[model samples]
Target chain A: LAKTTQPISMDSYEGQEVNITCSHNNIATNDYITWYQQFPSQGPRFIIQGYKTKVTNEVASLFIPADRKSSTLSLPRVSLSDTAVYYCLVQGSARQLTFGSGTQLTVLP
Target chain B: EPEVTQTPSHQVTQMGQEVILRCVPISNHLYFYWYRQILGQKVEFLVSFYNNEISEKSEIFDDQFSVERPDGSNFTLKIRSTKLEDSAMYFCASSERADTDTQYFGPGTRLTVL
Candidate 1:
């Protein structure tokens, strides 16, 4: 399993963009980087995923460099409700998942 | 969109008692997994089930833990004896295939050990 490290918390003002980065120095060849967002008292929901380069979706953007040692999750135009714990997962199959403490992104109003 | 479903949103059990957690994964998904998150801690993988057997298990999933697909629709995690340390939010996840990066999660079951 690929171990991941991320910030404990981040603050973002409403309408501002937020970026959370994760480091996975031992990422394996078959591993893929994925992010999930979790609000208090709720299960995590998938945000975005990428193997390399960059991938964007309606919710967030994933940027994985060629080295695959680190990845960033970008949230655009943050809102008050976007305050949640953001997890970065490095996985090959679903079985090999390793979710870190994640970045607690607090969107301020 | 279709979603994975877990039964008994919350459960409280005494220490040393057996508890069974049930889940219904998405219809087309081929891989199913169980994860648990202690309050204020990171989510930890427990085990993965595929082809009617376990593909991998974590050290956290010790001898007291077992998983079964009792029926076509229901997947279950059975903990033979609960401990206070076992209290956590257990989540069920499913992926369409082994290589698929997307793993849909079901609302977790909150297990309280006392």
Candidate 2:
């Protein structure tokens, strides 16, 4: 499993764009970067996933550069309801997904 | 938008007692998993089940812990002898496939052991 490092916390006002970057210097070829958002009392919810380049959905976008060592999760038009912990994980074909200390994103109103 | 569902949103039990956390994964999904997160700590994987057997499990899933898929829709996690440290939010997740498909997590069952 590749170890991922992310900022401990980030703050943004409502309607601002938030970009959270994760670094996995030892990412493997088969590893795909996945992001999950967890609320205070709920299970982590899948946000977006990408292997390389850029992938976008209705909620967010994932940008992976050519290096694959780092990836960014971009959230557009943030709102107070989006305040939660964001986890960036590099997962292979393995059965289990390891969760690291994620970045706590705080969206202020 | 089908989703996983867990029962007994919150459970409180005494140390050394037994507790069972139940979940109903999305229909048509084949893979099931159990994970827990201690308060103020990161989420930790416990085990993954596929084809009526455990495909993978972490050291945290020792003799005291067990998982069962007794029926078509119900997947369960049983703690034989709950300890104080066993108190945490237990989440059940299921994925369409193990290789690369995304896993969907349930709301989670909060277990408090006293």
| Candidate-wise lDDT, in order | 0.90, 0.96
Against the true structure, what is every candidate's RMSD? 1.5, 0.6
Instruction: Kindly report which residue pairs in candidate 1 clash with one another.
Output: none
Candidate 1 per-residue lDDT over residues B2-60, each given as its tens digit: 99999889999999999999999999998999999999887888998899999988999
Q: TM-score of every model? A: 0.94, 0.99
Which ranges in model 2 have alpha carbons more than 4 Å from their true place? none
Clashing pairs in 2: none
What DockQ would you assign to candidate 2? 0.85
After superposition, candidate 1 runs with Cα above 4 Å error: none
Model 2 chain A weakest 10-residue run by lDDT = A89-98
Best by lDDT: 2
